[model samples]
Target: MPDAASNDYSMLRDAVVFLLAAIVVVPLFRHFRVNSIVGYIVAGIVIGPHGLALIRDVEGTHRLAEFGIVFMLFTIGLELSFERLKTMARYVFGLGLAQVVVTGAVLASGALIFGAGWGQAAVIGGALALSSTAFVLQLLSERGELSSHFGRVVLSVLLLQDLAVVPGLAVVTALGSEPEALAWALIVAGLKAIAALGLLLAVGRLVLRPLYRMIAETRSPELFAAATLLVVLATAWGTAAAGLSMALGAFLAGLMLAGTEYRHQIEADIRPARGLLLGLFFMSIGMLLDLATIIPQLPAIIAAVALLISSKALIAAALGWCFRLPLPVAVNAGLHLAQGGEFAFVLFSLAMGAAVLPMEMGQFLLAVVAISMTLTPLLALAGRKVQARLEQRAAGGLEALMTETEGYSDHVVIAGFGRVGRTVAQMLDARDVQWIAIDLDAKNIAQARSRGLQVFFGDAAQDAITAAAGLDRARAAVITLDNPAAAASALRNIKKKLPDIPVIVRARDASNMGELMRGGATSVMPETIESSLLLGGAVLRSLGQAESEIDEVIEFFRRDAVEGGQRAADDEQ
Candidate 1:
């Protein structure tokens, strides 16, 4: 056996090498707009035992790297609330369930046609049916597409795939065991999963808030960070011990904390760790690529990858259509989910270990999965092209409306249809003024239209949407995007097109007020200032102050807020 000192030194060296490679490669790829995932994986290939042999203990590195996925799932959970999940339940459960059933059945039949036993074929089919949630979600997020219709559909299917891991594991475990025992194994697994989830939900409901409250009361950043990790790992462990996947446990823990006041703080603390660890995870996946075996089987590998992408894409698209998604959205979602997922590694490894899959077949399938993951970014690009073409075709039918702004002269254009924008539009309507609104949310547009409001479904910041909304002839534009960056972006886009038009933009706080003003907003109303002024007025009224006195005080403060920006401008001059 190696000396302890030598082993420790070797481990340190390998870690240093991996970090160095990531630091160099990830940014280089990102600078060119490539997914950092691809960069990290390529770095692993160059430094791993299979390539330059710079890192000899690939397995050890990979084990450590798995934590990245855990961190990612935790963060993903933090973003999701029960309400959000409830809204997407039909797609998440109905469509997600269908994708797995249909994709697996078809792929399994294909495997059977290739002469594999039903048991082995089933394993292969189930494994391939799962797509890389981590890869697709991260890719969409990097592109700022997660809130888009396509992104939500992709998420629903990926979420179901993650949930399906439990039963998939059970099926693999029961495959080579007694045939009658299969039912018992599934029953036991299902009960354990329910018990684990129930316990988590109960604890989360009763204890998580108070637990965080106590930790927050300490007012120690170090303690808070540690407590966050503890919660994530503990829940992950509990679920794993309960025979469910660790990611599921982490996700549940996140969901529990999501509605808490400290959700954003928890997310902020976990992000750095998630990014680094996820990079490590991606690198480890690259290290697993067996080029020696795969190169000789290139033709077959290519065929398998093509078949998998095509079949899964078709299946997902069909499901999307059934769910009533637009053709482009449904097709894009299908492409996003076409690649095989990280769970396939777990599923295949278990199946091989249980002797349900032959050694040769298992190795080949692993290569197939790895190659498919590598092709996902490329497939995503293709999906974008397809979406663009469909969008162009749709635009052809609206060319006259898209270009004609003559009838919209002096009409107010609201850039969002959320509460703030809705309030502004209602006031305009009350005055009998003409107005049109555009919002990114389709549901919001539909709801507003149902209420007899003139709201269009499109991104306000997009030049096309703004033009379609008749920005060139509008009396003024109101920007009320909740996201500060989006608000600033819409303001700038409006100014670029109609440089002299009055644009009133909302700011989240005083800090963003100047930024929005500089972004060419005619006036920036910070929500903080407005709320404080309103509160002051309400308090004075409650204290029985005369209405005139309250009005006088409010008017003075409002004048000061507006002049504060002018004073800064004068100072700059």
Candidate 2:
């Protein structure tokens, strides 16, 4: 047995090797416009036992790298809200479910044709069907495209796959010696896992917000980080207890926290952890590639990688097109998700452990997954360029609104074309006001345009849409969105980019008044307060009150409104 001192030295040596490789190779790769992921993987292969033999403990390194994925999921959850997730449910459940089922079935059929047993083929199919949530999401986050249409769909599909992978793991574990008995066991376990998830979400909804709020009040970064870590571990444990994966639990915990107020701070605290860990995770995967085992099978490995990337990409693209995404967006999303993912490592290990897959087959599949992942960033970059070209070609009709706004000055930019927006536009039009309006609701724009309003179909909060509305020369902006979240986002976007332009916003209640003002609204009109004041003024006039008395009452209410707004704003500060 090795002494403690010797073991410590070994660990230190391993760390130095890993860190030195990353430091040297990553910058070089980045200088060539290659993704840091490729660099990390390349570094791993070089310093790994298969190459220079500078580092040992590959399995232990892989285990440590998993925390990177956990922290990454946690941060991803912080960026998403339950409301936002709900909006993507169709894509998550529909497209995601279809992708797995169809891809798995087809791949399994192919595997069987290649002389594998049905059970083993099933395991391979399930494993290869999953795309890398970590790799794709990290890329999207780096590119700042997570909020784009293609990114949202890819995220939804990945989330569903994370959940879907649970059963695949179970299936792999069960398919070994007693296929029938364990298959039934997996079914029961899957049901229990679903129940556990439901229970977690229910309980999290009840207490997560309040719990984080309490943590926030303490105002201690250490305490808050501790709490976040606790939540992540507890959630992971809960799912593990139900025979589900810890990563799934971490993701759910993130989803719960996404609905809370402390999300941004939580994200900030965990970002560094996610980055380092993710780098380690990628490097560990690269280390798994044994050139000795792979070189003789080079032709076969290349064939498998090409087949996997092409089949998966085609499936993803076809699904996106079926979902009615724009041609470029569909193609881009498909290309982004073409590669095999991290989950393949888990599935392969489990299959090998259970003696379902022969060692040689498992190694080959592992190489395929690793190589595909290494190639993904380059493919995504090419896809992005192709998408840009397609978008440019398709830009003719899409540019109509921007063209209409060109060379115009002193025009009001109306952000919503709803009831209130229509009223405001009508009033402005009566005075010959030149204005351009953008709304996400196409039907609303169509209706308004039929009635001769200058309305267009586009999200006002989108930078492209706003710029097209002539923000540089706009006289002012009027926001009349009924959705408080959307209104707040639009308010911030406009204020941040066009601070010199004055803005008037319509608010549903006083609850949001302070936030709206803080977000840089020049004026916030509460619908209830304005309507009540209008009614009260009309009633006093009908009561035959003196004109001077009516004027005084109106003036008093207006002054009170201003004071109330000011107080709300101050309290927010």
RMSD of each: 3.6, 7.7
- Model 2, 450-509: lDDT tens digits are 777677765667788788888778999999998788898888888888997899999997
Worst 10 residues of 1 by lDDT: 392-401
Query: For residue 377, what is the lDDT in candidate 1?
Result: 94
TM-score of 2: 0.72
Give lDDT tens digits, candidate 1, residues 221-289.
999999999999999889999988788889888988888899999999999999888889999999888
User: Model 1's lDDT to the true fold?
Assistant: 0.84
Return the lDDT, model 1, position 533. 95
Error of 1 at 519 (Å): 3.2
Off by over 4 Å in 1: 143-153, 326-328, 378-400, 403-412, 430-436, 446-475, 495-501, 508-518, 527-536, 548-573
For each candidate in turn, the TM-score is: 0.87, 0.72
lDDT of 2 at 326: 74
Which candidate number maximizes TM-score?
Answer: 1
